[model samples]
Target: MRSRVLGSVLFGLGILALVFAGGLAFVVAPAAARLPYDMERTQSVAEAPNAQFLQITNGVAKVDTGTLRSTVTVQPDAKTTADLEGDLDGSALVWLVGQEVVRTDTNEVVSAYSTSYAVDRQTAAARDWNGQWLDTGSNRQSVKYTGHMYKFPFGTEKKSYDIFDRDILKAQPARFVKTEEVGGLETYQFVQEITNGRQDLPKDRLDAILGQLMPGATSGSVAYANTRTVWVEPTTGQYIRVQEKQSKTLVGNTGQSVTLLDALFTYTDDTVAKSADAASANRQKLLLVGVWGPLALALLALLLIIAGAILVTRRAAPTTAPRHAHPRHAADEDETAPIR
Candidate 1:
């Protein structure tokens, strides 16, 4: 009776454990995969003014260009607004607003870029950077951030992407060049290379535009290229640091490439620190939900199953016969022999 009761208790506990494990594996785990995506992320980078490009006596010289700062805001797109409530579509939208200030004057609008992306809510892979609200040039097809938004399951040997260049006004390839540490977090470094790419303007049109900036008479087509490097935290898919090396050149009738504007952009130290903290926290949460927590639950279920099996075996019927199986068999045989 004790064995039977113990077996019953163990069996019941084993079933409960299996149910819990199943719940965690099938239901809770899937929910956790989508957790990091449902929030609004706002980040701002400071661009300090430098005197390096101020005195260029080439195609374009800065007369009174002041400090320029840009703000980028990203958010989860609303379903109703996008008409993407169905199973096949989801999006994240961002607004890029740049402001320039001359000395102590109020901020003046420099440029604005609005981008929408079709991203998988669960996986965080962006399928497409759908529409551009205010694209300044005709080469709209070459835009950046086209494919997967974040590195899903991030550890990659090389991550490749195509991003739109604001300088060249086209999309180009950016690939992982190396890995480095930023803000106490290991990160992937990617570079976007553009070399002497054609611009949307005609030669005469470009000359007309450059005539205003340059002090001398210029005649030729204008072309531009840029190199943008970024350090991204893999776990959270956030950029901790960024650098842009851009230059515009005017190819005169003599095929000379004169540098018009050369500028570099970098992120503030505080931005890297904040991004690192957020990424570290995200890594901890992913480890708990996707790795350690499931492992623990599986271990508990295995233990319950083993205990139940042992108790059930103990409660099973005996397989062997008794030693004194026929104690009365001798007497019955002897009585039968005498009567014969």
Candidate 2:
């Protein structure tokens, strides 16, 4: 009896272990492998005339799930233009321009305007609340810029900027993780590591810029990061959406930290294709579905492993003795005794 019980326990544990191992192989590993890898390609692509201009329309709303509050949105239609200066060696600049337009739903003009600039192999620049332009320059060239925005009563804003320094063309180290389909478009995802500045410009300042762009962000300096897939039109190399989360950290009177998440930007293609070939290429890659395919397979494998384990344990265990065991045995002995 004890041996049987021990076997049952061992079998149960073995089955559980097998289930966990199967999950690791099918569910966890594959999903991890499917993460997007486009960001790295975006960074390395030759500058050439690869700049794409897009228009974005977005909206925001608040959602509650139990005790959690989330800000969800159809992000705003902010126009973006990426200009590749020359050949592969030249700098590529991406501009996010905020414009005034009538909201079809409300028919009101939104007053806020913002802009972001990315220089090839250098830091990005954007206007902050205090009217000071924040510049994140590259280390090699020491490239730096100062910008000022002029807002007119007519609801249009113009940004004038000058480069103060030049940085060397040392590309930051990055890796492509996965490819995904977002909003009917294929996207590439990448992870990058950026080095912080010393002395006057430090790591905290660099981290602040990313924090402002990301949602639920904390830590003055960011080490590991998460980003939604970046959708790119394959032929034209234009970005379809740049999904980011905005986070605000506040220190309460009790010295506790509070965080908030806000959707940042979603850009769509508004440019007329130069030719039909380009449009066709973009459409063909739209439903690519590489990332999610692996994820689904992983989940299926996890479920199968769990079910198999349960079945095996049930089959390996013994069944209970028949209820008539004692009666049947006594009758057999009496018949064999021959009238004793």
Candidate 3:
């Protein structure tokens, strides 16, 4: 009876353990995959040396050649997070991005812009929960955003993924190029080529450039092209390093054309190291909840279940009597019968 009761306890414990394992894998793991609300803001610095860009000063535009330094930052949007409800699988991640480019030689500000958008907590895909807004110094507009932006999905695969380009305002395929390692972590390299994608400039801005670059020409536009490459840590879907080969040319209706911007921007070494460290930390947490923890619990449950089955199915050995033993009660009975 004691063994059976012990067996029942062990059996119950095994079932409970199994349930916990399932919960860790299915419930806790998914929750862990969601982006954290207090995520760290990103600070990235990159530079392009010996590059060509347009310089506008005192309402006059001119093409110049120099080094360019760019600073990009990403942080959670406070207003959007407050607006989010109990939807989106309990995740309310929205990001505000700012980019500023300046001439390294003369410290002239070349380009500056800000953008705000929403992305899924799990997949990092663009979400329309809030409106997408872009603000340049000249104008601000509401634009539709799609596909991957600053981040990638957790547990990213080796296949192609779509990443959005700010210039074209569309998502393009980022094809898998090769496997490489960054700061001792293996990563997948993806490349995206935008062949002469058109960027529609504001009419006033376009006219101003045309007036300065091509005199007496009434119409012109800028043709944009870029070769973007990224090295992504697979497990955490964090970018380790990035390189952008960008070129922009102004074409006038009167058969005059000039290079507006030509530069190759690469993330600095310090930026890459910091990004790698963050990715590694996140990867460990995800693996523990999703893979290693579940596996260990399942194995323990199997052992307990087997031990319980043995105790429950087993029977105690029967009691044995000695053959040479004689009872005192037998002698008393024999004597009583003689007297009778």
Candidate 4:
């Protein structure tokens, strides 16, 4: 009886554990992968050495060569996300991003701008709503932003993904190059390149370069191109390291060209270390809950169920009763009666 009770208790507990395991695998894992609302961190500065860029000196646009640094910051917009409705309330994360480029040698500001965009928390894809530029040539322009901009989705696959290009103001396909390791963590490498894509400059900035760069040029254009590469941790979809080669050219109405920018920038060592640490920690947590925990619980449940069944079946099986012989007198009387 005691064995039956213990077995029944273990069986019930095992069933409960099995249900929890399913919930963790199917439900909790997804929720755990979401981007937190308070992820407002400033990234480390990206630096380019021996870079050439256009700079204005005494009201003249001319080419200058120096070291350049790009600083980026991202913060969650509390006011915007607080009022999200319908499918966006719990599913979307609104972020404000700002970029500043400067010449490190002369301490001259090259460019600065800010933008607002919303992305799905799960997929990290930009949505159409709440997307517009600020303080740049494209300020307040209606932009049709699509694809992954800031981060990749969790469990990133070995396939091409659309990434938003800032200069082109559109999404372009970033092809997977190969699998690589970053700081002892496995990651996927993706490469994106843009060739001769035209970009709009502020009217004043464009006007200054028209006659300065080319003679007899009224309407001019700026062509932009970039080759971007990133190493992203697959489990958390966080970038461990990144590099970009950017080039820009000024085109006169008669097709005369002048080089505006030619630079190759890479992430700082500190940034890569921080990213790798974060990814490693998150990856471990996800594995514990989704894979290891569920598997262990399932195994325990099987063991408990089998033990319970064995105990219950043994108790329920039929057994023969033992026969006993009577004492001397009773045996003699029974023997005579049995003969008749």
Clashing pairs in model 4, backbone N/Cα/C closer than 3 A:
none
In order, the Cα lDDT scores of the candidates are 0.58, 0.32, 0.88, 0.84
Question: What digit string (tens of lDDT, one per residue) describes model 4 on residues 32-56?
Answer: 8888777656465689999999887
Q: List clash counts for every candidate, in order.
A: 6, 29, 0, 0
Q: Write the per-residue lDDT of candidate 3 for residues 1-340, one digit (tens) a residue.
A: 8898888788878888899999999999999988888887898888999999999988889888989999999998866777776574355477899999999878889999998888788888888764679998887888888888777889889889999999999999999989999877899999999997988899999998988888888898889999999999988888999999999998998989989999999998998999899999889999999999999999888888888888898898778966657667766767756543
The Cα RMSD in angstroms, rounded to one decimal, for candidate 3 relative to the true structure is: 4.5
After TM-score superposition, what is the CA distance of residue 22 in candidate 1 from its true location, in Å?
A: 4.8
User: Where does candidate 1 stray beyond 4 Å?
Assistant: 15-19, 22-27, 35-38, 48-68, 79-82, 85-87, 90-111, 122-132, 136-145, 148-157, 201-208, 215-222, 251-258, 315-340
How far out, in Å, is residue 94 in model 1? Answer: 7.6
* C-alpha RMSD of candidate 4: 4.8
lDDT of 4 at 235: 84
Candidate 4 whole-model C-alpha lDDT, 0 to 1:
0.84
TM-score per candidate, chains pooled? 0.69, 0.27, 0.89, 0.89
Tens digit per residue, CA lDDT, model 1, 31-148? 6655243465556565646412323234444433455554555655555235554454433323332322122134544434555545555545544444433343323343444444
Highest lDDT, which number?
Answer: 3
